[model samples]
Structures are given as C-alpha cells and as structure tokens.
Target: YLNSFVDNIDEMKEKERYLMEELKNQENNFLGIKSICSNKVDRVEEISRLKIEMNRLGIFLKNNQGLNDFSIDDIQNKIKEIEEYYVSDEEINNLQNKINEFKSKIAYPIIEGVFGILEENFSIIDKKYEEAIYSSMGSRSKFLVVKNEKIGNELLSSNNSSISIIPLNKIKPKIVPGDILRNVRQLGGIPITELINFDEEVSKAMEFVFNGYFLFENKENARKACYDYKVIGVTLDGTLYDPKGTLCGGKIICKNIIFRRKDLLELEQSFKEKKENKRIYEKEKYNLNELKSKICNLREIKKAKNDIQIIENSIKFLNKLIESKVDYSSELSSLRQNIVKKIREKEEFLRRKNVLETEIFELKNKIKSKKEDEKNILKKILQLEGFRRQSEIKISKKSIGEREEESLELKRKHLLQNILKSKSKISKLRELLKEFKSGKNENSKSHLPVQFQEISDVLDDFKLSSNIFNVDLKIFDVKKEDELKKELFSVRKEIEMSKNIKK
Candidate 1:
C-alpha cells in the first residue's frame, strides 16, 4: 500500500508537470488571441465608421442625382441654337466670341451719324398726294441732313461711313417762277411749294429733295404741265415727266430707310436674348457637370463596398475566433484547479507517511529496549536455574517505503510543492480572470479604446471625409469647375491613403 501510494504521488507529480506545461501553453495562446482581438477591434471600428460615412456619401450622391439641370452636350446644343441666328457657326467655334460678334452682322442704324433724316422734316399739306413726292424722291428721301458742314465732314471721315449726309449750311434751295407754278396749278398740279411742310430752319434740305417735283392728277396732266412749264411734274402714280422729256415711273419704296432703325433695334433685342439664354445654359451646365462628378464619386464608393464587406467579414470571423477560445481558457483553468487539488492530496498523503515513519522509529527503539530487558531477565533466570537462553527478532520494511530520505527532507519537498502550487494557481487565476473579463467586455463591442491615438486619428479622417461629402457645392460656378475638379482629386487621394493605413 505504501509503495502504491508513493507511485500514485509520482504519477500525480508527472501529471502536474504536464498540466503546468499545458497551462503555460494555454496562457500563451490566450494572450495571443487576446492581443489579436484588441488590435483588430480598433481596425474593425475604424472600418465600421468608414462604412457609415461611405453609406452617407452614397445617399447624398443618390439624392443629388435627382434631375440634373442640363448635360454639357445639351448645354452646347442649346447655346448653338440660341446664337445660330446671330453668330455663325464658324464664329461660335471660338469660345471667347460673344453676342457682340452678332452686332457686326446687322446693318448700322442711319440715325447714328445724322442729326435727322430729310423726310422727318417734311409733311405735305395734302396727305392724299404724299406718295407723289416720296416716290419721285425715291432713295434721295433718305439722305441724312447734318447740323453743319463740320458734322458732315466728321461723318464722311468715319471709317464705317456709307450713308450720304447733306449739310444744312452747304445746301442750295431752288426757287420756282410764279407763272410756272400758276400754269401747273391750272393743269391740275398741286404745287410742290404748297405741299412742302418745311420749317425755315430745315427748308433748304427739304427743298433739295422735293423742290423740283409737282403733283398733277394723272400721267397725262403731269406730261402736259412738264411740257408747257418746262419743269418736272409728278402724278400720284409716281410717274415723273421731266422737262427734258424723260419719263420715270412704276417704282416705289416710301418707308425703306425708316425700317432700318426698326430692323436694327429688333436685332439688338434678339442678340441680348441670345446672350441671356447662353448665360442661363452655361450656369445650368456647370451645375449638371458638378452633379455628374458627385455621382462619379458615388460610383467609387459603391465600388469600394466589396472591400468594406470583406473587412466586416474578417471582423466577424475574429470575434467568433475569440469566442471559440473561451473553452480553451476554461480547460486551462480546470487543469490548474485539478493541479491544486492533487497538490493538496499529495500533501495529506505525505503528512500521513511522515507520521507513520516517526511512529515506526519509536516502536523500533522500544522493541530494542524490551529485547535488552528480556535478555537480562532471562539471564538472571538462567543463572538461577543453571540454564542458558538466546532470542532473535527481525523487523522489515518494503523497498519503496524504506526511509532512505530523511523526514525533514520530505517535509521540505512537500512545503516547497505547496508554496509553488499555491502561488502559481493564484497568479494564473488572476491572469485568467483578467483575460475573461477583457474578452467578455470586448465581445459585445461596447468597449471604446480611447487610449489609442491611431483610432482618434482615424475618426478625424472619417469626419473630414464626411465633411467633404456634405460640403455645399452651389457656390462654385462654371468658371470654377477646374478648381472643383482639383479638390475632388485631392479628396480621392486622401481616401486612398486612409485605405492603405487600414490595410
């Protein structure tokens, strides 16, 4: 029984040694897993924050995608349509060209150079026969009447001057004899002098255009008057009979020069409209292009979703891996508890063995003393009876139980074993408890590692990206499109840098 007990103690010692090794291994494994969990937690949280930002940016892009005002192509087409009437396509090819280019295409207003038109100063008293004078005057009616000869010289000196200007100071007035006028009246002629609605101030320019023409009722009367009076005669039909026997008729444009101003004013108004339309289209195109750029950013974000999801999956796997390690830790702690139990059991057995060995030593000494006493007593008896006697007795111990090692030595070993086992259990249990609490707390993801500056920096980056996504871009216009594109490129580079850091 003693040998078997010793063998049992040796077996427990061997088991304890093996279990201690396993405890060390388990501790290492637990710590390694814990470190991984801690490290990955920050990364996962960073990515999660990034994920939310990405989603928000994506939503922003989607909402902005609602209805872009105009595409660049559409804007160009609209600009072309608006300006085509005024500016030719060849002129439009130069983006610098503007609606002012169209002004050069329309005719200049005659009013620009002259003080007044010749016809504006005159109105025949007989409104019914007004056509005779204007038709006979023809284009001569449109001659510009300048304020003076100097003004006329200035007009003629201008590089773009093409209209004829008559200076009031330089014009000569023609007079008709009284008898010729009376004869034309007798021939049914309305005298040109009676028809002239001229003020003395502008009468010279007026008479220069209308003085020689007289209106008779018909071509026959006009011819008779021109032959009899040897002066120019005009009918209401605009047929002119010249004293030189030349007849002119059948052509009329009474209001041609008057329409010049109207045509130019209309063209100017239309050009302004085209310019305004072009401006509107340009602004719309700028907004549309900005929208397109944001949508492109949205596309990049969607593209990165796959990578984000993979990281999320890694986090899930890591969390599960951490949870799975819980069982191993439990086994390790159980082994430690068992080792303590075995140590206690071994201590108890050793205490009993020590006590039995001490008792056995006392018993052996008493047996030896009794043997001496009995031999002496028997010697006395032999002497008295003239007889001799001899006695022999042996006490044996089993080989494994033979007390080769001292009781003090065994006590020392037992005390040392107790101290080592107790201390190891206490420290290990403390460490194991710490690991459990850490793992449990972090498993729920409620823990924030505020101590890590890297995480703080990552959060700042996310906020910056968020701000970029939410930035109001309406302040910029078409002129600032290039600046916006540069900013976009820089933001993309920052995002890429952040991605690299996370990886």
Candidate 2:
C-alpha cells in the first residue's frame, strides 16, 4: 500500500510538470498574439494620426484664406479619444499571464482542452485584423483583378463588370514596414484595415510603383521595400500562384517552381480562392485613393478662386471712386483760380482808395479853416463900430436889440439845421463816387452825377420813401445783393453743364 502511494506521487509529479509546461506555452502564445495585435493597433493609430495631420494642414490653409469653419480644438478632443485605445506591452503581458492562470485552474483534461480551444479560437479571430493589414498592402498593386460579389457582398457585384488600374505611384499609402497595424495591436483601437467595394465596369488595372516611404530616407531600402512591392503573375492555365503565388506572408513568389506531390504536402495551404476577394478589394482601394486626390485638388481650387474674387472686388470699388471724383475736378479748379484773381484785384483797389481818401480829407480841413478866419474878423469890426449902442441908447435900445437878437438866433438855427441835413446827402454821393472809381458800382443810380446837387435830390427821395413805409433805405442794398447771388448760382450751374457736354 505504501508502494502504491509512491507510484501515485510520481504520477502526480509528472502531471504537475506537464501542466507547468502547458501554462508556459499558453503564456508564450498569448504574448505572440498580443504582439501581433499590438502591431495592428500601431498601424491603425499611425494612419489615424497622419489623416489628422492632413486635415490640420487643410484647416491651416483655410485659415490663411480667412475661412473660419473648422475648429482645431474640436479635432484635438477627438484625437484624445482615439488615444484611449493604446496599450503598453507590459500591461498586455500581465493580462496574458492572468488568462493562463485562469485556464490552468480547470481540474478535468476535457475541461482544460475545451478552454484551450476557446483561447485558440479567440486568438485566431484577433489575428484577422493583422491579416487585414497584410492583405491591404499585399493585394494593392497597379494591376488588380475584379472578383464576384457573392460572398456577403465583400467583393464587387456581377452587374458591373470591369477592372480598375491605378498607378501605384499615385496612391499615398502612409505605411512603411516599421509602422505596425494598431487595431490588431491596440486592444480598443479601430480596425487597421478598411474594406471597400468597386464597380467592375469602371475599374482597370495598370503597372506602376507604389511609393510608401519617407521622401528623404535612404534610397535603396526605401524604394525597393516600399515602391517595388510585386504582385502575383498570371499563368497559361489561369492559375495565379499555381505557377507561383506566395502563400506565406510578406515574401514574393515570381518564378514558377516545379515540386513533387510529397513536397506539396510539406508546403502550407495555398489561398487561391481567397485571392478573388483580394482582387476586388484592391480595385476598390485604388478607386478610393483616386477619389481622395480629386477631393483635395477641388478644395484647393475653390480656395484659390475665392482669393482671386476678393482682390478683384477691391479693385472694382476703387475704380468706381475714381470715376465719380473725376466729374467734379474741372469746375473745382476753375472756381479756385477765379477766387484768387478777385482777391488780388480787391487788395490793389483798397490800397489806392486809402491814399485818395487821405488827400480828400486834407483839402476839406483847409477849406473849413479859411471860413472860421473870415467869421472872427467880421466880429472884431462890429465891436469897434459900437456907435449904435453907447449913449443915447440907454432907453429904447433894449427892446429893439432884444427883438433883433431873437430874430438872429432863429435864422442861425435854420441855417445850421440845413447844413446838418446836407451832411447825409454828401456822404452818400461820396460813397457812390468811390464805388464807381473802384469799378464795382452795381447801383441803379449809375446815371446820376457825383455832384452834391444830384446826391441831395436822391437822398431826399430815399428819405421820403423810407418815411412813407417806415423802412430803412440801407436795407434795399442787402436785398439787391441777395438777388445777385441767386443769379450767380444759376449761371454757375449752366456753365458746369456746358463744360461736361463738351468733354
């Protein structure tokens, strides 16, 4: 019974060792799957970043053109959300170990086997995203074949029958070997590949290099690895890879290799049927690339036209201002010149009139001095001849003298009133004479003489008229000036119109 216990202990030890090895294997397999998923996730993220950068460039271009439709802030928020799916390798390894530990806890072999199958199945499905990235790059050729659209409509429909040839050089694929697929790689990232459908009628295949590398990198490696990717060659028997199509990923099979049936058994399964979906897939990819380029060019053209129109409008507005200002220019110049000439003439006339008035004032002072001397001499002679009043006169002389003095005062007062009245008449006559001399006489009394007699008659007539209406004679001159201004305005308008017609 003790020997049986020892045998049982040995069996348990063997089983434990086996379980440990299985656990280790499971861990390694999960790690490998995680690496593949990580690579896919990287590819998805990198492509997304590049698309974002392109969109940013477009936004900057619009901003430079003064358009304000897009917001960089909003785009940055979206980018932050996309970043959430990224996972570190260390974290993935930790998760893998946990899954392995959970799987090892099953007691029955059947249960363990079932769990292993499940794990393997999940891992395969996860690997499909990586396969998508490889397929997208591999089947992408300048030359592509159209496929039937029967399988879930993943390929083109039969109603449309054509192949599309895109020059690979024109396609802007943003991937290099180092850039991994992020969806398969990152746990929560978007799928690394996009499937598109094509109309076979409008599709055609062509031969060209696909440039999928940094422009400034080393020439040989960048060009050969990226631009010179090869496609499958067609054979006489209508077989793609039977002649030579690479079954294993990332290697190209160009020349036909004959192999025995035993060698064929050793080789991996050839996915010739899957190539049909790939062909339509490639055509759809080329179409999408062409469409994107057309869209970019159209946006650029629209921006250019908008800029041109703005400049054109500014030029037109300035031209209109110039055209409108031109019509007023000639009249403005003539009026300015006439004003200057009149100012100069008025200045000269004022200088001459001042000198003439000084001479006239001196002559009037001399005449007044002569009249005063004569009156003084007559008063002295009358004092020496007092024979009428000295003696016998004491009596009746007082009444006769009083009466005569009263009569003399009355006569003097009448003469003085007449002289004062003559002053206004003389002033008006002198003003008329001055205006005539200055060549600015616009008075209606132009036929009247410059002498005092005619001036007195005109002044008397003005006084009589003013008394009758209780109006000042001076106001008549202001009324005449207003009428002259109205006449001048009408004349100016006529002259301007005539000048425009001549022009």
Over 396-495, each residue of candidate 1 has an lDDT whose tens digit, in order, gives: 3443345643443554454345434434433443343344346654432222222123333433543453354332334223334354345444534544
Per-residue CA lDDT of model 2 for 116-178, tens digit only, reads: 111111111333233332333344422222222222132223215443323222333343232
Which regions of candidate 2 are displaced past 4 Å?
1-281, 326-503
By TM-score, the best candidate is: 1
lDDT of 1 at 266: 53
Report lDDT (CA) for all predictions: 0.59, 0.40
Worst 10 residues of 1 by lDDT: 387-396
Residue 110 C-alpha lDDT in model 2:
26
Models 1 onward score TM values of 0.29, 0.13
Per-residue lDDT of 165 in model 1? 77
By TM-score, how accurate is candidate 1? 0.29
Give lDDT for model 2: 0.40
Taking every candidate in turn, the Cα RMSD to the unseen true structure, in Å, is 58.2, 52.5
Worst ten-residue run, lDDT, model 2? 112-121
Best by lDDT: 1
